[model samples]
Target: MKPQIACVLIFLSVGIALGECDELMKELGRSKTSLGGLANELVELRQIQRRVGRRIRSWEDKARQNEVYLGRLIEQRSISEGWLARFEEINRKLLAGEISSDDKEERIARNIVRIAEFQAKIDRRQATIDFRIGKIEKAQAQADLYRSRFEARESVVADIEEQRDAKKLLVLTLEADLEACKAGMA
Candidate 1:
């Protein structure tokens, strides 16, 4: 009777061991699934980061080009001012009677029209410069926004990596436990 009781107890223990092993396997499967999902998310985040980096580089290049254009606009404006100054001096000399001739008067009128045309060009150029500056500022702002998003995604990826590592460790431990249970049963 004692031997029979011992055999029953052994069978009961084996059953419990098998059940525990089955549960561990299920848990390991779930962990592996979770780790796979995390890995996919990390890959997506890396892709986004690369795209954001490219956008930042493109914006920087546009800003540099705008700066060069602005410089050229400034030089043109300076030249226009110089021409206006010379025209003003000519008008002042005419008014002071230091030069008197119909040709001189005609020349003065032509200079006035030329100066007016130059002023209009300067105004238009200034407007264009302002528009370019606004666009550059907008591009810079977009670049900054993209950089922030990239950084945020990087942090999320790091967290996901940590979780994946922990899951991997848990799965390994569960596998070891399942192996031990099988050995015991054998």
Candidate 2:
């Protein structure tokens, strides 16, 4: 009678322990699945961030190019304006009869043509520079928006990592406690 009772007690104890182990195993599996999903999301987010960074770099390069072109246009405009001023001064002298040199008259006529050409070039370059500046400004704005999104994702990634670490610690603690409980029961 004593042997039978002890055998039944052992059987019941094993069944209860097996149930608990199954439950813990299920929970661990769930945690692992969640961690895997989170990892996949992190990978996708990182790829998107890389793309945004590339776009921002492209915009910056274009902006730099436009700035250099704008500088050149400004210099050209300054030169053209200076030439026009000199040509007007020469014309005034010629009209006032203060200069009677034929060479000066011919030089002033040539300068007028040159000034017209320079003015046209300056106008064309200014238009191009203006268009490029507008494009660069738009690109910069888009880049700023992407950068903000990247930062937000970065925060999310940090949060996920922290959660995963905490979850792993929890699993470890649960496993240790479960082992101790089993040993005590035995």
Candidate 3:
């Protein structure tokens, strides 16, 4: 009768130990699953960050190009203004009859055509400059938008990192508990 009682007690202890081990295994499994999900989230966030960075770079390049084109347009307008000024001076002289020449009428007609052409060029250049200015404004707006989105995502990434760290710590704790359980069973 004493032997039978000792055997039943041992059997109950083994059953309790097995139950604890099973519970620990389940907990460890849950921790591993949570860690994997966090890692996947981190990867997705990094991809989003890279894409936003690319958009910002593209906007910057477009803005730079617009600036270069605007500069050229300004230079062209300046040259055209100078030519128009010179032509106006010549026309004024011709009208004033400051010089007498056999081909005075022909020279006047030629000067008038040159002045018209210079004025047309100046007008065209001004239009182009206006258009480029609009484009530059649009590029700047796009860049600002990208920057805003990037900053928002960066904050999210930081949060995710913190979550990942916490999950890592949880996993370590779960693993330590599993090791202790195994040692107890041994």
C-alpha local distance difference test of each model: 0.89, 0.84, 0.92
Q: Report the number of clashing residue pairs per model.
A: 0, 0, 0
lDDT of 3: 0.92
Candidate 3 error regions (>4 Å): 1-57, 154-186
Q: Residue-wise lDDT of candidate 1 within 2-45, one digit each (tens)?
A: 99999999999999999999999999999999999999999999
In TM-score terms, candidate 1 sits at 0.50
For TM-score, candidate 1 versus 3, the one ahead is 3
TM-score (C-alpha, index-matched) for candidate 2: 0.48
Clash-forming residue pairs, model 3: none
Per-residue lDDT of candidate 3, residues 142-180 (tens digit): 888888999999999999999999999999999999999
In candidate 3, what residue range of length 10 has the lowest lDDT sum?
93-102
What TM-score should be assigned to candidate 3? 0.52
Clashing pairs in 1: none
Residue 89 in model 1: lDDT: 81
